[model samples]
Structures are given as C-alpha cells and as structure tokens.
Target: MIKKHLIYKKDKWNMLTVEVNGKTLILREISDQWGEECHTFLSRPAMMHWVEERFPKEQFEGSEEEWTAIMQAFKEV
Candidate 1:
C-alpha cells in the first residue's frame, strides 16, 4: 500500500511525503516558479536539505515516523 502524507501547503507550492513498498520519497509542486516545478527526492540528505532551506519545521504535518525519517537524514550528515 502507498501512503501519502502532506507535509506543507501554501500558495502555488505544496509538499508531500510518500511511502511505498517500504521506500520513502519527498515530492513537491511549485507552480509559482517557471510555470510549475515538480520534484521528487529519494535521497535523505537531499530531502532534508531542501526542506530545511525552504520550509519551517512547524509547518510540517505528518506522522512521527515520517518526520523522524527526514530528521534522521539530517543527522546522518
């Protein structure tokens, strides 16, 4: 089963953390930039870096496991 959790949402931009077949991914949609930008991240560090750079921690909305997965990536670096 595929599980999707919305981590953040705002004008023309939103992010989703998805779990599928035991793998995790971060997906983003940014309609405000260049007519629309879609991104997918499987790398933990990449996910952590992008989220840390753009969104606030308090804005995240997801399960503890999902949040921990992202933070664990940050700590691994």
Candidate 2:
C-alpha cells in the first residue's frame, strides 16, 4: 500500500512523506529556487560559493530564494 502525507515544517518548507509497502520516501522542500537565472548565471562554483557564504547546512545547502527568483525569470515546461 502507498500512503501519502503532506506536512508543513515552516512557511518556506514542506515535507511530503510517502510510504509504499515498507519503503518510505521523504520528499522535503529541500530547496525552492529552480528558475531561469539559476540555470544561466549560477555555475557549480558560483553555487558552491553562494551556499558556503550564505547558507550553511549539515546535509543540504543553497539559496532557495535565488532559485525562486530565477524560476520566476524563466518559464517551466
């Protein structure tokens, strides 16, 4: 059986927990920014710099707001 639960951790983050059989998939909001400029100006080095300088994470990192802004500047297909 597959069960889905929608959970909100905060205003900018969410958790979608899905269970199938005995397996669980935790799809977190992790990062929200996934737009145009991100795909354009942000390279791996740039991203690493931004993540390191602005956001610190134990496991994950990056500026979700930047992603959002870039995404807003572009269109999703």
Candidate 3:
C-alpha cells in the first residue's frame, strides 16, 4: 500500500507531499507557479538536503520541532 502525507501547505502555489510505498519514499514539491517536481530519496541525508533546499527552516510555516519531527519520521522510514 502507498501512503501520502502533506507535511507543509502554505497555499495552492506552495506545498509538500511525502509519499511512502514499501521502502521507497517520494518527496514532491507542488507549486502552481514553478510547477510540480518529484524527488526520490534512498538515504536520510539526501532527503534532509532536499527538504532544507526546497523548504528552509526560516521560511517554514510550522515550529522548529515540528519540522524536526517530520524529518525524524522520514528517517525512520
């Protein structure tokens, strides 16, 4: 089975989707202006880098711990 979670959503133009299927995790950045982009991560570090690059902590809508928890969840998967 595949599960998808919306980790962050500021508006229609900016949102992040994390999709998990078995052992594969797919991160998708959905934007109306920039268009949709999909990234597949096989390692924790790569996933972290993509998160930091696409969604900076300073500009994130949630708390720092919330962001950390999101990453931690990814790490566990």
Candidate 4:
C-alpha cells in the first residue's frame, strides 16, 4: 500500500513523506518553473537535487515503486 503523509505546505510549496517497503522518503512539490517562466509541474531534477544537497548525509537511493510513490505524492500534495 502507498501511504502519503503531508509534512508541511508553505507558500507555493508542499512537503510530504511517502512510505514504500516500510521506509519513508521525502518528497516535495512547488509551483513549476522553467527557464525564466513559471509553468505547471515541479521539476523532478530539482526535487532530487534538493534532497541530495540539503540531506547530503542521507544515503538515499530509490526503488521503482518509491519513485512512483514520490511522483504521486507530489501530485496529491
């Protein structure tokens, strides 16, 4: 089962936790932006980068289901 728990929502962004295989991974959603313009879906690269940069100490690697859950979490959050 996929479980989504909201961490927080501030301004135009929302942070959530998605559980997969009994482990929880962080996922975030924000108003999409491209180049010098704002658009519709959040950037996947940006989301991965944020997790890597801010939580460098974490040994994070995602499974296929985890990735799916992350995407769904962003959409539903």
Candidate 5:
C-alpha cells in the first residue's frame, strides 16, 4: 500500500513523504497569489516550481501521463 506521511512542519508550507514498493517521493503544497493551494495548474509558473523541486530528475521528455500521475499523487494527500 502507498503511505504518505508528514515529514516536517513549516510556517507556510509542509513537507510530505510517500513510500510505495521500494520507492519514495517528497511533496509540498503549492500556493497561489493569495496563498491558496493550487495543484495541476500546468500553465502557471507554480507548476515549474513544483517540477523543479519535486521531480527534478525527470527529463521532461516523457508522456503527459507521467506528470499527471505525479501531480495527482500530491493531490491525493
């Protein structure tokens, strides 16, 4: 089963971790201009930030489904 856990606490954001099979992922909440959480806004610069931090190893030459899955993973929490 996939397990997501709170790894750290912060004033304006949080650090979360998810483990599945033999792999792990770290995620963070993305906020908007008003500090509202917005996930899956691929057209926004925030998405660039998320990609840079969350999936830095990704080559960005894969299918869109890959990105969707990553974003959905964070949203599922």
Candidate 6:
C-alpha cells in the first residue's frame, strides 16, 4: 500500500508524498494546478519523449506496473 503525507507549498509547487514499501516519492503540482499528486518514474521510450521535452534531466525509476498503479492512484485523488 502507498502512504501519503500532505505538504504545504509557499510560492512553490504543492507536494504530495507517497511511500510504498520503504521507497518514498514526492509528487509536486505547480501552484494553481489541480489533479493527482506528482511523482517520478523512470520514463519508458514513449513516455521519455514527453519527459525529455518537459524535463530533459528529470530522473525516473520503478517498474512498469508500479508506475501504472501510481498514476491510477493519482487519478483517484
């Protein structure tokens, strides 16, 4: 299961922290943006296209299924 902690943002991106097992991820949403929390995942070939376009240097990790579930959970928020 993923555990989350809400974080306050002051002139910064809103943050949501999700921890699975012992791994922790900080998902950020820009101020004024709404939707699921933000987190990082290793970008796949197709995903890398956009990841690179927006965040060329962003780092990604985790299995394919793990990422899928994470995204789904974000949508639930």
For candidate 6, lDDT tens digit of each residue in 1-77?
Answer: 66554332335454444333334444454544675555554423333343345333234354666455545454443
Residue-wise C-alpha lDDT for candidate 3, range 1-77, written one tens digit per residue:
98887776779888877888877779888888879999898766777787778557788887989778766655565
Residue 30, model 6: Cα distance from true site in angstroms: 17
Better of 3 and 5 by lDDT: 3
Clashes of each: 0, 5, 0, 0, 0, 3
Model 3 residue 59 CA deviation (Å) reads 6.9
What's model 6's TM-score? Answer: 0.27
lDDT of each: 0.53, 0.33, 0.77, 0.43, 0.46, 0.44
State model 5's lDDT: 0.46
Query: What is the lDDT, from 0 to 100, of the residue 70 in candidate 1?
Result: 62
For all predicted structures, in order, the TM-scores are 0.41, 0.23, 0.63, 0.27, 0.29, 0.27
Question: Candidate 3: lDDT of 33?
Answer: 86
**Global Cα lDDT for candidate 2:** 0.33
Tens digits of per-residue lDDT for model 5, 1-77: 65544432344443334333234343344333334332434233444476567565466544777656655644554
Model 4 stretches astray by more than 4 angstroms: 11-26, 32-52, 55-77
Better of 5 and 6 by lDDT: 5
Q: Model 2, residue 42: what's the lDDT?
A: 26
C-alpha positional error of residue 63 in candidate 1 after TM-score superposition, expressed in Å: 22
Candidate 1 lDDT over 1-77, as tens digits, reads 66555443455354334333345554544444545454567675676677676545666676676666666544443
lDDT of 1 at 53: 68
lDDT by residue for model 2 (30-62), tens: 334531111112233443354344334433343
Better of 2 and 6 by TM-score: 6
Better of 2 and 4 by TM-score: 4
Q: Which residue pairs show backbone clashes in model 6?
A: 27-38, 42-60, 42-61
